[model samples]
Target: MSHPILTEKTVLLNANVKNKEEAVRLAGQLLVDQGCVEPSYIDRMLEREQSLSTYIGNSVAIPHGTEKGKKNILRSGISILQIPGGVDFGDGQMAKILIGIAGKGNEHMEILSKIALVCAEEENVSKMIHARSKGELFSLFDGVN
Candidate 1:
């Protein structure tokens, strides 16, 4: 019983978090709630962040588990959290969009590339940040590949 990579149920809109850690937790928790990964995966996500920032340019951050954490994944999935207010990712990086991913095997590379293509355009990132509803946010990733 594997879940879809991304689903409307996993898209959260208008989220408000005090910091990047909290934001990451919310994003990772969505994956957990959707049964994409085990509870331990969230800790690994934080560990990854500590080692290297996942904050890509254009006010977006993609957080995922470390290599060892992959074993905790139940299936491939993505969870999106839109924070209109934004959270600080340190070193002057503020991320309004948080994408948490859990990929089985090499699916993560595909997922990362797909997400990169969609997020390459600044306008798309802006639209995602200001999305009024979960459907709006979810639709932005539709047909992403």
Candidate 2:
């Protein structure tokens, strides 16, 4: 199978998710819509979250993992989710946006580094949190190339 990058996947616009659970579900839905993953992928992702928190810091969380080469066989998904009340990130920080990425083998670190670079910029994070549509969010990565 051909493993593509995050840009090749479709994004979910106007994801009105309030918390981490809903955010993960929305991302999984996006993967499903893009024919990247199965419907059960969301449930598995949630289970992983329950096992351990994916939040890193600075209002960012990357809830990610790989399955038995089944549902989650995509590259990555940069889901710009808005946590209405914020979710505890285990470091006195509340996650405002989630960038859910799913890939294979050693490709995770590179994509994760890209995500980290994007999150390191406060301006970028702000723009993502306030993004009104998927088109706008996709535009954020325009210069990332």
Candidate 3:
């Protein structure tokens, strides 16, 4: 069974973010701005992105990796950034939704999988892209099982 780490409440729909680098940076900043993560966390994420493009298929890109901890840490967040020009995901697809998942160990995968499933849905994706507020974004994720 998978749990949702990213609730719609945390999602920012149609964000003005543009480009992959900006998307990752914005996601990290949101985490810090919301007091959900440490400032240094962004650097770690940037390092990871430099290694490879974290853009997955389906116009969705999940940029995440394990933190520097031995045990599991359940720190996860989601932000829906709408790139009007579309960011290159290295897969020849422009990404509009940036789902950032950060944590330690494997527990976060469950939530990540849930986000993946929700994003994979055509109806959900359209609604998510058109989402207006944090509340509406959260509503899209409601009852997602």
Candidate 4:
């Protein structure tokens, strides 16, 4: 069986998280639940955050595993977490949208670029943050990449 990169089941809306770590865990958990990656991948995601912030500005953050975490990836997957309340990503950067990614092989680069493009627009980020339903959020990501 094959899974789509972004599924409704993986898109969480109105998530309330205390901090970036908790946010990353929620996003990573979605990918794991979807059979996209191993359980250990979440740790690497945290490690990556510690090394460098994934907060890309415009109220968006993209969290992905380190190079070593690649081994834990079962397939390419993207998880979206809509945090309307927002979480502090350190350095005064509060991210309202958290995108967790697990890509197989060289697919991560492509996924990153596509996500970057979508997130670059402030309007799109606002739409994602305020999306009332999973379907609404899914529509924002439709045809992405």
Compared with the true structure, the alpha-carbon lDDT of candidate 3 equals 0.63
What is candidate 2's local distance difference test score?
0.65
Query: In candidate 1, where is summed lDDT lowest over 10 consecutive residues?
Result: 136-145
Off by over 4 Å in 2: 1-4, 7-9, 66-71, 74-78, 82-92, 143-145
State the lDDT of candidate 4 residue by residue for 11-91, as single tens digits: 999898888999999999999999999999999999999999999999999999999999999999999999998999998
Clashing pairs in 2: none
Quick one: best lDDT, which candidate?
A: 4
Q: Ten-residue segment with the worst summed lDDT in candidate 2?
A: 3-12
User: Between prediction 1 and prediction 2, which has the larger lDDT?
Assistant: 1
TM-score of 1: 0.96
Q: Write the per-residue lDDT of candidate 2 for residues 1-145, one digit (tens) a residue.
A: 6534444345544446556687777766666676656677677778778887888776778876545433455544444455545666555768777776665566667777877887888887777677776666677666433
Q: Between 2 and 4, whose lDDT is larger? A: 4
Q: After superposition, which runs of candidate 3 have C-alpha atoms over 4 Å from their true positions? A: 1-9, 66-74, 104-106, 143-145
Clash count for each candidate, listed in order shown:
0, 0, 1, 0
Listed in order, each prediction's TM-score against the native is 0.96, 0.73, 0.76, 0.97
Predicted structure 2, TM vs. truth: 0.73
For every candidate in turn, the CA RMSD to the true structure comes to 1.1, 3.4, 3.9, 1.0
How do the residues 54-115 of candidate 1 rate in per-residue lDDT, one tens digit apiece? 99989999999999999999989999989888899999899999999888898999999899
CA lDDT for candidate 1: 0.90
lDDT by residue (1-145, candidate 3, tens digit) is: 3434555444665566546777888876666555446667767667778787777666767776435521223354544555545678765777777776665455466767777778878787666666667776677666532
By TM-score: ranked, best first: 4, 1, 3, 2
